[model samples]
Target: MSTKALDAQPKFAQIKQYIIDNIRAGTWHENQRVPSENELAEQFNVSRMTARRALSELTDTGILTRSQGLGTFVASFKSQSSLLEIKNIADEVRLRNGHYSCTVLSLESMAAVAPIAIALGVEVDSQVYRSVLIHNENDTPLQVEERFVNPTLAGDYLQQDFADFTPHEYLSHVAPLTEARHTVEAIMPSNEVCQWLGLFNEEPCLQVIRRTWSAEGIVSFARLISPGSKYRLGGHLTFKKKQP
Candidate 1:
């Protein structure tokens, strides 16, 4: 927008729109660093704080990402999940034409704690299979999957290569899902979570507490974490028409 036009309305909003317009027009591609606050302020004849607000809002909404000492850049394409169904993470990334990979951090049998036992419908201190993994999209960390499995249902849980096939894929093969439940929350990331996801301290995360059931009983309890700027959950529905 021209200086005169920008002056006609809220300058900060106009600056935000200007950046968004450039991005939409492909003038600024993904991972391409945009102008600094000082540059933007100089261009728009506004204070740095006004320019900073424009950048900050876009960053919070996932349109842009700011790296410490590295200026702002357009955000990478976000990974998305279904709110209506259980879907595999690998498939979700590939559906967006992005490469998918995973790192299996830990896989072992552990005694269930009370909360885990309650979630998994198991007795406290019972042996359960636990796996911790980081799912990546295009080599960038996307989701942290920490799961506790009912050993009776998936007997060979620890033997498989999770880097080759996800826990969701393997569990589905062993004990097909009869039902699933999910609870989502936005939370501040722990230091460990931040390190795993390569997230800054200010970035919030989306946490999903999930439980899956098979014909016999509860199969697993899982905690899924994703950086708010890197992942989203959504669903679409169509309503039937009523008789007029």
Candidate 2:
């Protein structure tokens, strides 16, 4: 597009694009305040109303947050997770504009036991990376993820800092997931499960056993447990006929 064509666009639209570009470039990060409308107006050589229009539009779209006494800051990201597919807890929390956090209870290289080896479709005593993770949304504990990973899928599993990234996120980047299966059910909490999720002995827990696959073979098997009283399983799907 020519400079004249660009200049001909609506001032608010241009300002919005400029702000978006800065955000995409990491010049502005989450919770970081952007320039005030007065500052933006002066910088863009536009009226305050035009500048506010850009900020207002972004705020409405869940990009920016506005406060009465304090200045506007970038809104936290939050979204719903996919129940039918492998979803990263961090990504799901952020999409819903909620804070996502994790505690890595354990990350170790261990020999897969009989059940774990069967789940991964590998020989008994095969090497695997195992981790225990507690995922939280907005500071409240939600789920405990006990996962056994095929080392071939995520060779660097023990090195990465899970506090900054989730195993699901890491696996997606390293090993492409071709498919996944999830089975959810409610069960009486075990001693370990009760402690990890802060559930009482009598309380039942919602458990989701997920098996993910890659082109090579089974990628990882995860047992996700959460307090039944606190969370209910959810899913999103579209109804359609099978293609011929």
Candidate 3:
């Protein structure tokens, strides 16, 4: 490694930018282990804490990853997708000429809250299925879907292979649909959600609140939020023609 003069920024910030620049320049490849904090400090003529801050910030930003008893390594870069449809995120990615994948963050059975129950037309405190899914386009985080399903209609949803099949596909096969509603807005992502989406501080997100109903009642409710730079929602409606 060359010992270039560090920039005038804070030692940590300077070190952070150095690492990022090297990574961008391809000096550090994906999954490649970076130098230890002590080594970096020696190379940069800084304290170990300063070097550690650089690595820590990168890790927090998902540019690098650290493992206990192991070492820090470069994180893989990701790409985003733009698809406007009420469909499976994985399918959307695939259709957009990108690779599609998902990570199931959590799957559990929980009691529905009053608002959720009312939306699903189920009794308050009824058992409901909840799932948190992180969908990626071309290995880049695109959206985080927090979904709730009426277990009375779609039972054992937690057992399905979401990576291979979408909730929309499974629901369409099982549930009888009647109506659908959607509301879109903008919001800042939470820390956890931001990590899930691999978003930077400047990136805003488009938040979509959706509800689907069946003959029996409301069947599902979901909150889907995507990085604004990566997604946009669009639709078209036509009015009925009156007989002359």
Candidate 4:
């Protein structure tokens, strides 16, 4: 860590970045315990509170995990998605050398409720397609996908065999998303969702509420949920410096 660089940011943020950089550089690895607050406070010449804040923030962001008696360790992100792009979950898992599979729990057309209608930009009680699926990585359920589709966008949604292709892949072929919006939050999933994802009691889930549009109209609205400890969202962006 550079002294000038350390001076350039808040003490806690600098320390946090130092830890992140180390993790990125492979100095610290998954399941490896990180330095304690006392050790980091001494190294950074900051209070234990500052060091603790750095660790807490990282842990909250899913970069680290903490145990009661054990120290903080790098979190093993078994499944990851890019915050910058829309991708197929099956492909995402396979890219990481994990086996991908899915079970279609429900696939049917139904009358849209108020929230589903609004999300799909359809009239209340209008016909829409809904599909519920559990996506797995290495036979462990990693995500629970609940999606409502605009019939105008993907009329054949309920007819396809999801075993042959994911809903994302099917929709992309028919509609080809021109725009998308996503909202992410940490949530305590519903009992059914927890059961599908095989999460323990009180375990937090990362939820992404997503809406996508084609050149025609809103294509689909989806809620994708995963156990926070097993999945993570990340992105990398590079900005070019402006000319003087």
Report lDDT (CA) for all predictions.
0.90, 0.82, 0.79, 0.89
> What tens-digit string does per-residue lDDT give for candidate 3 at 43-146?
88999998998898777545677888899998665422223345656655553335788898998998889988887778888899999988877687788999
At residue 90, what lDDT does model 3 achieve?
64
Rank candidates by lDDT, best first. 1, 4, 2, 3
For residue 157, model 4's alpha carbon misses the true position, in angstroms, by: 0.7
What's the lDDT for candidate 4? 0.89
Ranking by TM-score: 4, 1, 2, 3
Write one digit per residue (lDDT tens) for candidate 2, span 47-163.
Answer: 999999999978755677889878889766432344766667776666544588998899998998999999999889988999999998878778899999999878899999999
Name the candidate that leads on TM-score. 4
lDDT of 1 by residue, 1-244 (tens): 6778766878898888888778877999999999999999999999999999989978755577899999999977676677898989998776444589999999999999999999999999999999999999889999999999999999999999998989999999999999999899999999999999988666889999999999999999999999999888876587999999
Note the residue pairs that clash in candidate 2: 77-94, 77-97, 78-94, 78-95, 78-96, 78-97, 79-95, 79-96
lDDT of 4 by residue, 1-244 (tens): 6878778999999888888888878999989999999999999999999999999988755677889898999878656688899978887766444579999999999999999999999999999999999999889999999999999889888889997789999999999999999999999888999889887776889999999999999999999999988887887698999999
- All candidates: CA RMSD (Å): 12.5, 10.2, 16.6, 11.4
Candidate 3 Cα lDDT to native = 0.79
| Steric collisions counted per model | 0, 8, 0, 0
The C-alpha stretches of model 1 lying farther than 4 A from their native spots are: 1-76
